[model samples]
Target: MTKCIRCQVDVADNHLNCPLCGIKLRESIKDTHVSYPEYPQIAKRKKLLVKVWTFVTISIIVFSLAINALTWKVKPIGWSPILSIAVFYIWFLGQDLYQKFNINLVAKTLWNNYLILTVFFLIVDNVTGYGKWSLNFVIPFLGIATGFIMTLWSVKNKSMWRDDIGYILLILGVNVLPFILFLLKAVDVLWPSIASLLYGVMTVVGIFIFSGRRLLYELQKRFHF
Candidate 1:
């Protein structure tokens, strides 16, 4: 039997990867193999599609920017950035949907959404005559919502708490970002930043108080500190 380090489960000798989280086992046998057929060509086609799509999107962005620059005096609406953001979002969302079919990458999807929406709104805010709504309210609330969703996800997968500490730490950092932004005077609202910071602090404190020594061990193993 081969043991999966992430899920802490024993895998059969015939399986090279863990059934749960798909991590490779250290003691995986080279000669032992499954009866499933491989599809290398499908993966290659996917990669080719991604490359082609990226090139096409970048070309579109360049063309739009060139046109916008030529008509700067007549139409200075800053529409190119919004168009570029939309194109990038479609590409990223497509990639996420493709990967999510194979792996449980919901946390990564949430992080991607957070980044895309934050940037999208910031661009929109700037384009709309510096409304300041994105930094003042939207981003901090978005971070809080993301952290909440991630927390619920960890709870739903209670069996994988040890494996989940990394995500928790990452979300905690996300929660703390609003405070940093406030300190830098980037975010005008103090209440939202304080709320996000307090939420993150409470989550970390709850984990430490409840987990005790196991949390320490997991932290040490994950961070190598």
Candidate 2:
């Protein structure tokens, strides 16, 4: 309880000032209020930086598009758009996902590179000619790389993966896409699809060897079997 010297009032609340006297309370008063460090200024600065980076990146994209418009031609199809994409990708990496320190950086980089390259190839194919590489090789390889990483993660951290294996298995099911593409006669080359099939098989074998009984546990949990 804080006693107001001026009003001779005994206050029962915890505050820096007297309720009736409206004067500063003594530091020796019991039951001091809880203190918390202020971080709003730092948070505001971070937000400001994000806004600045967004503006700068958008400006660069506009400039690249202007250049591309001026240099539109045959065969090359003006490479400025590629430059813009690259710049945007870098900005996203630096500003958005770079601070995610807990995630596996190597796996993140591989997946990001796979998607970015796939997009770049799609653009190039659209401008020049569609060789089916982006749809055939690029997408399938992305799945292969991601599956490999997920398998390694599960094997390396079996104790955790014991409970989380179902999601990983479901995601790895994308590797079946290439084989489906082949069966639909969507792709003339079978080697890429065969490679994806081989990757899927390897992953399954790895899960059996490394995950073992845990894999069965996760499967049962997933399927309610």
TM-scores for every candidate against the unseen true structure: 0.71, 0.63
Candidate 2: regions farther than 4 A off: 1-43, 70-81, 104-116, 157-167, 208-213, 216-225
- Residue lDDT tens for model 1, 175-224: 88888988998878899889889989998898788886888888788779
Q: What does candidate 2 score on TM?
A: 0.63
Worst 10 residues of 2 by lDDT: 98-107
> Number of clashing pairs, model 1?
0
Residue 147 in candidate 2, Cα distance off native in Å: 1.9
Count of backbone clashes for each model? 0, 0
Task: For candidate 2, write residues 1-225 as lDDT tens digits.
Answer: 878889898887567788876898766445567789886797677778878888999999998888778766643476776777788788777775533344434444545665676687777665556787776787778778776776576457653454446545654676778889889987778888889888888777877886689778767777899
Query: Top lDDT: which candidate number?
Result: 1
Question: In model 1, which range of ten residues has the least summed lDDT?
Answer: 98-107
